[model samples]
Target chain A: MTIWQRLRHTLRHGPAPLPAAAPSAETAAALAARLDAAAQRRLGRSLAIRHVGAGGCDGCELELRALNGIVYDLERFGLRFVTSPRHADILLATGPLTRTMAEALARTHAAMGEPKWVVAVGDCAIDGGVFKGSYACLGGITTLPVDLVIRGCPPTPWQVLEGLRALIEANATPAR
Target chain B: MSAAAAIIRAGAASGQRPWPRHALSRERWQAMAAALDAADAPSLQGVWAEAERVHALFLDAGSPLAASVEVDGGSYPALSPHCPAASWFERMIHDLFGHTAEGGRDARGWLDHGAWATAAPLGPRQAALPPRVGAPEPPEFLPVEGEDLNQIGLGPVAGAIAEPAHLRLTAQGETLVRLEVRLGYAHKGTLGLMRGTPPRAAARFAARLSGSATVAHGLAYAHAVEAALGVAPPPRAVALRAVMAELERIRAHLDAAAAILAEAGAAFLETRFGWHREAMHEAAGRAFGHRLMMDAVAPGGLATDLAADGAAAIRAALAALAAELPDLVRRLDRSASLGAGIGRIAPDLALRFGASGPVGRASRRASGHGGDARLVPGYPPYPVLGLDVPTRAEGDVAARLRVRLDELPESARLLRALLEALPDGTIATALPAASGEGLGVAESSRGTVWHWVRIEGGLVAAAFARDPDWLHWPLLEAAMRNGMLADLPLCAASFGLTSSGVDL
Candidate 1:
């Protein structure tokens, strides 16, 4: 159909229906409860994340970007990506920690405020994944004190969310 | 014929496919560098180096040819003085291979930022040293001389969920005078890792070269491997490959549109575009096993055939997108903020960099100089099924977006056609243990992705995968000149260059 017809059809029909809720919604209630308890306890119901890429292929970043889409709606959980490490409550690090980016990643982690968590995302961030044993890489994010690890060549957005939920649940103090 | 192609044709052919690779003497290689000074010179596509030789790929007219010169006494004649596009590649070649470009314009290090344990890690074994100690030294940026100009350093780690790269912007007030991009922060030693491994084992590295262009990279690497072994994949595999490529292009364009809209502060529009992108990803996941389809296009053929109901899932997703795309595009065209002619790239600039894909099409739209690998190098299915190459004469951010918008429907159409005529046959063919050099080219979302591979006894002896971003990154720096600093992100999103793609 011509663009005009498509526009007219849209005007008459309002708009196409939004796709059904993603498969991740099946575990939404459990994840929301866990996120709520942890966020309320330590983060004032909000978590600011700073992403540090340390030389792995950008596959992890792609999945991370998906979290902000309408379906994932990451901010609705009070989780947001921030620009500066100083403003971040958690450092979401990816890549195999290549030597070139090692110092920068270290500085970024050092710059973050206390009570911050380092959540290593992707197998490369855990132990270099496919890039293991390369001369230029340091294997993984060994310089930082990692609090949680999300495993996958690149974990799906759902898996990342589950990993973050677990991070909060493990650290947040129980209500008296 | 272009001087470079003439020289390439005269040399001994080395059995590369789609295009030929020729071994040239030192004198002839120097002559090719001199020939680039002519007004009608072929564009320099890429420059890479191995332990004993350095190679240069060039585009003459619409076809590609490569020439390699043996590195005697550890140096080769520099092409950067004549062709500015070769400057970065020359620097990278020196850094990685430790081969000097004698009389080269820029002698500074490209990828080595002092954090590495050794110098010239990919160079000869004797030259490799033990790991260095302490913090890495800062990279030096070119000096900008002018009155009342201050410099601002942006990254190495900047923006939200973006790969790391340092940007040094020298500005007078709000207008950027010079924007220098310092990359290599995302370098993962991909080439070094690929060496000594079988093509099948090393295909994963190519697929991951750029996450957004995984299918394109994978397809190109698979083609290179197939060419080297003199094996042809089943017809069904070839058609399926095209299907995945078009899907990836459609999804990536949607993501680029969303980013541009988001930068323009069109929240509702941005979300709508993101919604479409999410649907595409879902469709890909349902069709293939992976959301990104990483490692799906393996050497020989495919890792697996399409899942049951894959075609139905893909058709549903396309129908949904088709219903919404026109209205969304109309809304975008009507938005004054998005339509403003910001980030204009001249056609000459695009041609000089050998830009391809949407960015090249948008810039060279009026000139009709843009060439898609699918059409030029002539791949199967694409040549028969045909493609509608979209273009926009404006060469600005809006023009780029319009080109992308125009491409979405065409891709949807192509996908539908491909799915309808889905070939029925064995999905894969066994590859034989053989050795040769081959070049594989694929038109990716960002631009053309070229993978050059040399196999020896069924193992990858040397490999270089050049993403179109190597050219587009330089174009981004050029386009940002004299523009408002605030528009940098918007302009970059429109170009859609990836840092990790070239950081390898």
Candidate 2:
């Protein structure tokens, strides 16, 4: 096909439909409600997440990446990943805290501004999961004050969204 | 004699299956190590240690061979001096097993950054040293001497939503003079964790060793266990395993292509690839019940059978991908920015590093040493149903992208063929409670994944899973030499090396 024809085809077809297994509208609505309520109180309708991979496998990191893709569209829900911890309001950490990374994780949490929240993603981050007794790891993100924990070998993208919603709701004041 | 034949003939035959493994005396092992510098030396695949011996895996003229040397007085002759690829593994062995590589190059510790409570946690000196009391000292990097070169350290955590690894780059203006990757931040003592556990239990760790290559690693681990027990998974299970592997390769290649496009500032192409990747993952979830297919392949057979509608879901996803792939490829070809000479890997360097999978295929192209594990050390179902391995000569970002693009359809075709000929039988076969040593190799999206397992009485005695990143990371370091700092992301994305896989 010619370039013009291809462009026309793309424009007419639009993007492919999302998969059938994408989270339901009600799930999205519940998350939006929590985000809205949190914004009214203090969050301003956005949560900037700074992800730190402690000592776990890359499973959680993969799921977290999925959240930013078109399917999950995490940014649409006012959540986005940032490079620097100082710019973040929520520190999203994964893995069992390896000894080499324990200090770094602690420092990253400290760099965040006050009223910050820590959400540990994955079973390893919850309590070291499969790596619990390994000598090289501290077995979870316990050195910092953790406000939320999402558990799975590596939690799915939807589970991570729910955890974020729960974090906002728990800290969010009741709608006045 | 060939290095492999020499090593095998010199030592007493060990029980390792599907590949010959022999236990050699220190002298013979040193002789073999010395021979590694020869022009026709076998390629070093991996190196790891047990309490009593240090083992090395080699790929000799498309055949897998293993050799071990008993550690006398907790020290053995090092292979790094003869084989540059063995350097990292040698250092890692020293750190984890407390076995010194006598006269080894770069004696610095690897994977242990003074963070562990004890030195050589897996070694004989596990409790000999006093616990570390203070904050660990900063890691040492090779000093760069140049008037204008300034060093910049990036990540144990970096800009991307990826694994943690520290990259130290010495640069003159925007051009890198040297790039040194200091990893181990993601080390969870995976090998130590697998010790003494049943193969079924330890398979979980293998599956998680690199989440992106879950099926490949899991399949390799299963293959190793099956080999050790002399059990073969049912034909249907074998075909399904191959099916899952192809699905994984397609998804990974799409993700990789998307990452490269995103780094190159081609947002439209990037989004399209991302859409396809997510669609693939969703199909996997629908078919196998997990987006990543984690823990799906177990030691004996599979954890569960494919869903009833699994074939339909997979076919639909592949059809959509196939429909859009041509336009995507055409657009990618027209984008001059991506095709520019950036992050190019030389063919000689690729061969020396034993680069495998798409990375190797891109560099080596049609020439020999396109180290696809499935082809080399041939595996089931894949061999029975013929396959085509893609090749590209450029070895740049564009070449890697082209290789991946070619692979997507190849994988899709293989998936369709496997589905059509999907055999009907039990999905699992029980492994006997037996003892033996086995090595398993699988071609992951990144490259060849090697898992070495020794099962003692149905329990894992000692194990090591070597991800291809272990070899490819050094290639990335070499590729980035003298390249612009801004091109680092594109180079990294093109290589698609995972830190956790190597860090473990």
Candidate 3:
């Protein structure tokens, strides 16, 4: 294709956006159970998340980065991965909890304001996937309450976005 | 004596070219270092220590044979001062196994941050240490003395999307005086986890060692086990392994290019490249079960054979990537501003640091060794198909980016060749129960990935998978010296080094 044609094509017909992944029924019900009308009013549409790599291979991190790519376009869903945990409403973490990074992860979670939710974004974060009982890692953090777990070797971008949407939608409902 | 001749004289065996082992006293080992340094193409493959012996492996640039030197006892003379490439390996051996390199420079911990449940988790006496308690103090950074220098600590946690690494940059004004990288925040004790497990079952640990280089690690581990067991995979299995490996290379390079473009402030190019990468992942997902091709290249062969439809889908994806790649390259090359912020690494620095893959290749130095196992004697298919190794003399971020871009076509060509020549045979061979040691090497996206496995009573007694990052990360430090502090991230992105790969 010619440069002009390529430019025109990009300008006129942008790349296709990723289709939303439908979350499981169980996930939807769990979100509904946790959130209520009062919670919905308190938490608005937007969720600022701070992501932590406690101790992970870059698989989940790459998938997490992909969530913000042109294809996934997570910004369109009012879910932005913020730089600071203090401004975040959700702490999205990947990797098993390694002792070296444990304090950092705790500090990050502690920095987030109250009413914050934590979403474990891969099998490593849910429970140590391959590095389960190794001397170096403690699997995922159990000290803090976890709100949701997205499971995959490195969960796809859609799974991450879909999980975030569920968390945000839970904020849209009233807590019991 | 020539390194090859030394190996031959030491009784190197035929089949996978077993490393000729020569046990030497500390004095002799130190003396051999001088001889290796005086050689035209001196190189250090890796330095590792077991319970009773510390070993060093060396390979010359053009030689087919590898020499292993064993130094009995807890300490061995350091090779880093003379060879330079053994710096991190010695540090790692000290931390992991408590084997001190008597004269080694840089005694600081490479992968230990002192927060382990027990010190020297891989050492023989690790079980005797009382369990660790309470959060340990943060790692101490080695000080760079200067009147006006101030340090900028960038991460263990920085931006939300960033990996876990601590970069201590001592700078005078905006110019970097020295950059010391403290990694190991992502350590999972993968090597320790492989102990006592059969090689086939333990293959999962290798696959997960570095998520991005899963196929390369898998192939390396598989090859190690195969070599140890004296089993050769079927021809079709080899072709399938090549197919998966090439697909991985395609995705990895695309990801690296996209990251470099993003760091260069070319968001358009980043997004376009990212789109292409995702499309490739989608294609890979259809062909293999996972987008990253994780565990697809299993021991003996693949986890499963590719169906005719899977082959067609993979072919279609490669065709699309091949068609669009040239235009992408043209646009990237046309951008004069893109190369402006790249921190320059000298060829000698790359050589001294034992840089591999694109990072080493960009330097265009004799030290930039293209140690692809496929090209190694007795390694099949690659020699038969013919492969091109690309290199450049710039040793800057742009050169590294160019190398990555240049490699895309080669990966595509390999993919096509492998697909066309897909042989008819079973996809896997049953592994033999054995007790022996073997070495595996494969050309990963970044560079040569090496795995050494020792099987005892049908189980892996000891295993080590060395990522290319072990060689590349030090080069990052040298590249950052005398560079603007702001350009460090761009330079890092171009190198595409991973903490998990090295931390393990």
> What would the per-residue lDDT of candidate 3 be over residues A41-148, giving only the tens digit for each residue?
346779888988888888888887778888888888888988888898888888988878888888888888887888888898888888889888887766567878
Individual DockQ of the candidates? 0.55, 0.60, 0.72
Clashes of 3: 6
Residue A154, model 2: Cα distance from true site in angstroms: 2.1
Worst 10 residues of 2 chain B by lDDT: B1-10
Off by over 4 Å in 3: A10-15, A21-26, A36-41, A174-176, B1-17, B39-41, B64-73, B133-137, B366-373, B376-378
List all candidate RMSDs to the true structure: 3.6, 3.0, 2.6
DockQ computed for model 3 against the true two-chain complex using alpha carbons: 0.72
- Stronger candidate by DockQ (1 vs 3): 3
Docking class of 2: medium
Which interface RMSD values do the candidates have, in the order shown?
A: 2.3, 1.8, 1.5
TM-scores of all predicted structures: 0.94, 0.94, 0.94
Q: Model 2, range B1-504, lDDT digits (tens) per residue?
A: 576458656788888987878888888898888888776688888999999889998888888878999899989999888888988998899889889999888788779999998888888778777888988778989977869889999988887587889999999999998999988998899999899998998998999899999999999999998988898999889999998999999999999998889888998888878888988988999999998999999987899789999999999999988888898888887875684688899888788788898889999735455768887788998777888888888889888888899988889999999999889989989888889988998999999999999999988999999999999999999999999999999889999888888878
**Per-residue lDDT of B22 in model 2:** 83
Worst 10 residues of 1 chain B by lDDT: B125-134
- Choose 2 or 3, whichever is better by DockQ: 3
Query: What is the lDDT of every predicted structure here?
Result: 0.85, 0.86, 0.78
User: Which regions in candidate 2 have their CA more than 4 angstroms from the true location?
Assistant: A1-41, A166-176, B1-8, B336-339
